[model samples]
Target chain A: MSYDFMSVQQRYIEQIEAALEGAIGSEEETLYGVVQEAMRYSTLGGGKRLRGMLCLELCRLGCGEYERAVPFAAAIEMIHAYSLIHDDLPCMDNDELRRGKPSCHVRFGEANALLAGDALLTRAFEYALRECDYAAMGYERGVRGALTLAQCAGLDGMIGGQAIDLRFENTRQMTPEVLGTLHALKTGALIRAACLMGGIAGGMDEGQLELCEKYAAQIGLAFQIMDDILDVTATSEELGKPVGSDRSSGKTTYVVLYGVEESRKMAQECVQEAKKCLHDLHIEEPFLYDVAEMVISRTH
Target chain B: MSYDFMSVQQRYIEQIEAALEGAIGSEEETLYGVVQEAMRYSTLGGGKRLRGMLCLELCRLGCGEYERAVPFAAAIEMIHAYSLIHDDLPCMDNDELRRGKPSCHVRFGEANALLAGDALLTRAFEYALRECDYAAMGYERGVRGALTLAQCAGLDGMIGGQAIDLRFENTRQMTPEVLGTLHALKTGALIRAACLMGGIAGGMDEGQLELCEKYAAQIGLAFQIMDDILDVTATSEELGKPVGSDRSSGKTTYVVLYGVEESRKMAQECVQEAKKCLHDLHIEEPFLYDVAEMVISRTH
Candidate 1:
């Protein structure tokens, strides 16, 4: 049987794309125009758009309307976009290429790129907050959902992880625990938040929310490890960015610390854990299950 | 005669300082320790603490409860701190000194500084969300407040202003209108947010909220103009940071575009407008009015 997972993910990506486009519109005032353009530049410059799709899918699975989740899906993607813009800055990663295009700074200049990233990050919350006016969903649930998004995006979550990653760069000894912490905040925080926010938006009870979090945590790490593996194996053409860029930057990765085989095994184990969590939930969504498997198995 | 306004503003600042200390307790682990330390590095570094004090004052004036505004006050300060950290980055403002100490990047390295700034910005929301839950402020209001904060900080507000400022640097002759737009976003947005959020938290009526917004807008610009004037005149020893840094950077200022006398005259007019708004509110407290005047008259 052909695994229809890619098709399902593609559909989800399209939905998120439409939602993002709708959310970013503005009139012709100078300030608003600049903001709208900056937002478009960072977000429209594409990637997998996975954060948004996962959020929408989980919201649907949790019994929330896909429409209700769309704002949040766009918001999370904005956050992801902002992080990429800033990460590519000269003071940071200084990458010239992203998604096969000149980086934001290279295209728009450093000042605009910095401002663009900052704008997108701030706009993420603005989008998430629009959910507050969704009369169909209870206001309390919307507030909780936005709050969850903020927490994940903030210090204790994604930003914190990024700090650790920056601090540990170029160090010869990289501990497993440190690496885990870094990935947890850097990559895992936003993913877990995406899952949790969906559940919260869908009005999941504590138990269902817990299950989603567990699954999300596993897949999030698996996703990062796969990214690490891809850095070593994938070509620039396939990856749409430079391969071996991570190693060249002197940044540590799972493959560097654990070797390729062990790292792959670790990623596989994470997928298995994610699957077990889904199985325990007894939900019959084959799409989410397949997506979990694909998190580790994908080439890029 | 003693200025009761000065005393009252001082009292509010003291209360916010105490509450902020309580809120930022010890870190849980090394990871959290780093996060917490970075937060304190910025938050604890001294400015006038105007934003936090304004938040508490607004809460008290609107809600008649200073205690309830503590988290919001802290959250606003966190946002302010994060912005300063980012603004001082090498690629941004490139300031080596802030508040008489080495900048965050200078002390922590560029990567950690960037992460610290990100964390503080993110944590501001986390702290605010916690308040939404703990204060039992209905979810609708909490979401609205959070959304408002995001809008103020986002592209349409703070980041947008910063973008224009950078774009105009050493390249274009700026008009007063352009300078106003830049200052509104760069400085006015958060100040206005501080006042508005305080009112929101307190559940103020629409009229009162509008008054606070008006007052905040005037004062925010007034504050920036005052800084511009000080940059032209204040010595480094008195200013705590390098004096005339804005001039050195070849950035436009109120004093540069308009003559110093004209900028000073405009600042006074703005202060008068702000006071008029407060007067229309018929508030019992005279100290807030005094604080506004003091803000305009401060030497450093």
Candidate 2:
């Protein structure tokens, strides 16, 4: 079961980094500088870049080339980075640090940080709309992918999840169902979107898209549950954030609700189920398989 | 040349109020509830619905039907309301009160408020998309209208304006040029979007759409400058919130930078220019003419 996690991680990271560098451009306008800086500040600092990598990896696995999904991969990362920036605001998580550096608002004043997040979120779609090769795949697919990302990031999905999380904070107890709903939204929505965008970018058929959706859903949840476990088991140095910060914020976690052993078991099952969906896909990449495992094992 | 401002204001307000009542739906789902409440809080709280009225008035003046433009009028207001909700967040303007009521975040908590804003924004497009019949005109016109609204609300337009506003706050003494740039974004972008949306919604020709854009740009700046003036001259009772609040925040303003007399002159010029664009159109409605004047002259 053991795999070369380090090499796979490095390869995915390199691919995502290269894509991002190619996607962003230097334009000299007053407004462009503000937007470019905000986007760079939020995205350049490295976390796992897992969402971007997953998008690329899935595109490769589903099709043959990773380049086709570059816009979507970059877009997903922008969305994730913006969410992190907003989530760390003084009114929200209030953390001073992210990925071992000062959070966006701490580095760029609160107003710029807020604007940066908003700009990044909006720019993601603009990038998709303007840069995505609609001609190659036809306008309908491109428009659909852009619309999907918007819907997933907006009300019924990621934002809804954040709202629910905020509402549930400091409550005495939350049902497992409610916690699952929250995770599906706050974290799962974007992850699902990353995979779906990859599928759409790759021009996968409806059946393939469905398979990707199921696989993404499983890995997304498992990734989040692993985060819950790490909050308790890993140190701030290893996690690159204050350990048990979720608990301190009075937020519920899978580990807290289901216990560490059961949480781990559930995460394993999720990874397994996700893999099962890919069983018939004829995927050739060993790296994508390794990524699914890494999703469950990441400390941060 | 002074006219009956009070009656004109009342009539416009009444029109917008009735329109909004029909636009918002009462739904029980948590997501829908948030959207409905935010729309009501932001749109129905007794501030003059000048934006919506402008859309209606411009449609009439452009030789289009008010009935045909009503949905667009409401949609533009929804977009405006969403911007205001997000702008008032602790990370942005952090305003505690809006139109005499506790701001969306203050009353509903930050999470719900954020979701509400998001829902309203998404629903705006949904509203426009559904209204894409173009009545008996054509599908091309309907599609064009929807796309126009989307582009305006997206990064290149309203979102871009907000980005510039965020970047400029508390950092620099804004020049008149900078003030124009900011107002063009913060105010003119959406106003232009509203006019264009209404024109296209009513199947207006290219010439008409172009004329409406000019008209909207003029009144948009006029409206914003007047707002800046009232922020200094009007009291909380008149404005439905504390006046001079922008001054207290140390934000840049038209009046602060240009002085009251110059700002008024600029607004007057903008209105004149807007009217001149429509001189050859041969508009039928006198109300539309009154609105163009009233928009520049309003105190609160």
Candidate 1 lDDT over residue span B1-300, tens digit each: 655665776777777667566555556566646656766777773778888777777778876776677778887887888888888887778888888888888887776677777767766776777765444556667776777888898777887787777777786478878888999989999999999988888888899999999999999999999999999888997787888887887878998888789999999999999989888878767766776887888888
- Tell me the tens digit of each residue's lDDT in model 2 across B140-166: 455455556656765567777777776
Worst 10 residues of 1 chain B by lDDT: B131-140
Clashing pairs in 2: none
Leading candidate by lDDT: 1
- For every model in order, what is the number of clashing pairs? 2, 0
- lDDT, residue B57, model 1: 79
TM-score to native of every candidate shown: 0.94, 0.84
Query: Each candidate's DockQ score against the native complex?
Result: 0.60, 0.32
Candidate 1 local accuracy as lDDT? Answer: 0.80
